[model samples]
Target: MLRSIKARKGWTARAPDEDFAGAAEEWNKWFDADPSARQGAKMPVRIAGMKVPIAMIAEA
Candidate 1:
C-alpha cells in the first residue's frame, strides 16, 4: 500500500508507526536548512473526529 501511494504523484507515504513528532522536527530542520525545500509543499492534514484521515478508509 505504501509503495502504491509512493508511486502516485504528489503523495508521500510516511510509515504508520513512524515518529510523527520526530518527522515534523526533521521537516522543520530541512526547511530551515533550505527554504526552497518548502516551496509548493502542502502542510499535512489533521482530520477532526478521527485520528486517521477519512481518505484512508475504503468508504467514507
Candidate 2:
C-alpha cells in the first residue's frame, strides 16, 4: 500500500539511465536549495518518556 507522504528532510532526483550526481540532467529542479533542509533537521528519539534531539551526522 502507498503510504501518505509527509514532509521530508531532504530529496534528490535521479534519471533512469543515469547514476546519482553524474550528469546535470539528473539534478533536482532546485539546485540552489537551502542546505539546512538536509543538515539542520533534528530527529527526536523517545526513551523512557524522555525526548532527545538527535542531529544527522554523515560519515565522510
Candidate 3:
C-alpha cells in the first residue's frame, strides 16, 4: 500500500492592521497579476502599495 502526499499550504507575514487572510489575498493579487515591475525586477510588497510583510513559496 502507498500513502498519498497532500499539499501543505505555507505561511506569510501580515501587517499588524491586517490578518493572514487579507494579507494572503493582497500578496496573491500583487504577484499573480503579471507581477513584473521596476523594469522586470522582483521587488518586495512595496510595489503593491502594501506595507504588510510576506513570504511566499510559489511554483515558479
Candidate 4:
C-alpha cells in the first residue's frame, strides 16, 4: 500500500505518520493478517486530490 501510494504522481514521499508499518507488524505477529480489508471497504471519491481506486474492490 505504501508502495502504491508512493507511485502516484505528485504524491508526497514520506513514511506514514500513523505508524502503519508498526501496526501491520503487530497485527501480523498474531496471525497471518488478511490482506482482504479491501474486500468490503468502500473507497472515497477523492482522497487528498486523487481519484480513488474504487473499481479495485468489490462494492458492499
Best by lDDT: 3
Candidate 4, residues 1-60: lDDT per residue as tens digits? 432231211111223345445545543443343332422223323357653232233223
lDDT of 1 by residue, 1-60 (tens): 322221211213343435455545654553443332211222365445433311221212
Residue-pair clashes, model 4: 0
Q: What is the C-alpha lDDT of each candidate?
A: 0.34, 0.32, 0.39, 0.33
After superposition of all CA atoms, the RMSD between model 3 and the true structure is 13.2
In model 1, what are the clashing residue pairs, if there are any? none
Over the stretch 1-60, how does candidate 3's per-residue lDDT look in tens digits?
Answer: 101212123344543443645655654555563442211122334445665334333332
What is the Å distance of residue 8 in model 3 from its true position?
Answer: 19
Model 2 agreement with the true structure over 1-60: per-residue lDDT tens digits: 111222234433332333333433322243334222342222233246543233333323
Q: TM-scores for all candidates?
A: 0.28, 0.19, 0.28, 0.26
Quote the lDDT for 40 in model 1: 24
Per-candidate clashes, comma-separated: 0, 0, 0, 0
Model 3 per-residue lDDT at 40: 18
Stretches of candidate 4 off by over 4 Å are 1-18, 33-60
lDDT accuracy of residue 48 in candidate 3? 54
